[model samples]
Target: MSAIDVRALSSVPVEPWRNGGGVTQTLATHGTEWRVSVAQVERDGPYSRFDSIARVSFLLRGKGVTLRHRASVIRLAPLTAVEYDGGTEWDATLVDGPVTALNIMTAAGRYRTTVNPIVVATIVPPGCAAIVIALDSACRYSEPDIGTDGSIQPGQFMIVISVDRPLRVEPAHHGAAPPLIVTIEPVPARTPDSNF
Candidate 1:
């Protein structure tokens, strides 16, 4: 993987849910290993289940949403994220109106995932396997010898690859939705058959 993979916000095909709950747009993916996407929920409905996967999701727009799991419930508000086992059955209830959720799914136990809101200029987590999404304003980045430099347009995203170096992320401008930095690092799961 390269240091940065830039992608503009373009009109991509919308994938409507069979239940007519809403639509979804996949922003980027790395084979079957992991995926980044945005989902818009128009009406309360059940969330899709992904066995053997771990999910970390946050609200991108709208009022907020409530996630109903078997034993507990979760309130998903703007700037807040929720992580849970993807295999769990869950239902969504809109609070005030429809909401858009940004989600990252990675095969369970295969990778370590982190989603952080850009509060200040910071380095891209080591390994450089991350995704940077511009929320309210364009996101800027700088790194020596790195192929990417400039502002990522609002609503756009950059898929970073393996670049073992420091990648700095500037804080979003005032009055803009803070950008998100999602990092995914491979962590091979040990098998019982393997020697200790």
Candidate 2:
């Protein structure tokens, strides 16, 4: 959980939701503390609730969808993230057809997460934990050989971070699509000492 790890998307097992609305593949986890996953929405339905978690989601494929909350509707576009409480009740309406989405969730107050879409080469600096996902096509890495020879197929991912230096990432050679970088940081503990 403290260092870098790499994985293939196809190797993960997909679990169907209890409501049968979609299937999800969990790529990584810090045990019960947090998780990163990708989901395929096969139909319109309500999302599952996670009482003490913070959820950030991004649309990876399909036209997109509108998340209907109690008093508002949030439209999800490819690569753009919409963060909300994991306990929030929402229904999804597909804009076109089936949708593929990525989700980053952390136990509230335990960690912080940020997701960014990259169209060109990107450098993941040292000191933080990060996960890189191939979005458009396959992705190429500068070194440390994640996936296959520094390349991972679209939807495949790698994680594990080195505190000693930064890692560079780039798109595939032809018809490339931007990849996404997710940075995860531990939230500093709050004390009665003072307001930070």
Give me the candidate number with maximum lDDT: 1
lDDT of 1 at 72: 82
User: For each candidate, what is the lDDT?
Assistant: 0.80, 0.78
Q: What is the C-alpha lDDT profile of model 2 across 9-32, one tens digit per residue?
A: 788899999999999998877777
> What C-alpha root-mean-square deviation, in Å, does candidate 1 show against the real structure?
2.8
lDDT of 1: 0.80
> Estimated TM-score per prediction?
0.86, 0.82
CA deviation > 4 Å runs, candidate 2: 1-3, 142-149, 153-155, 161-165, 172-174
What residue pairs are clashing in model 2? 4-160, 4-161, 5-159, 5-160
- Over the full model, what C-alpha lDDT does candidate 2 score relative to the true structure? 0.78
lDDT of model 2 at position 84: 78
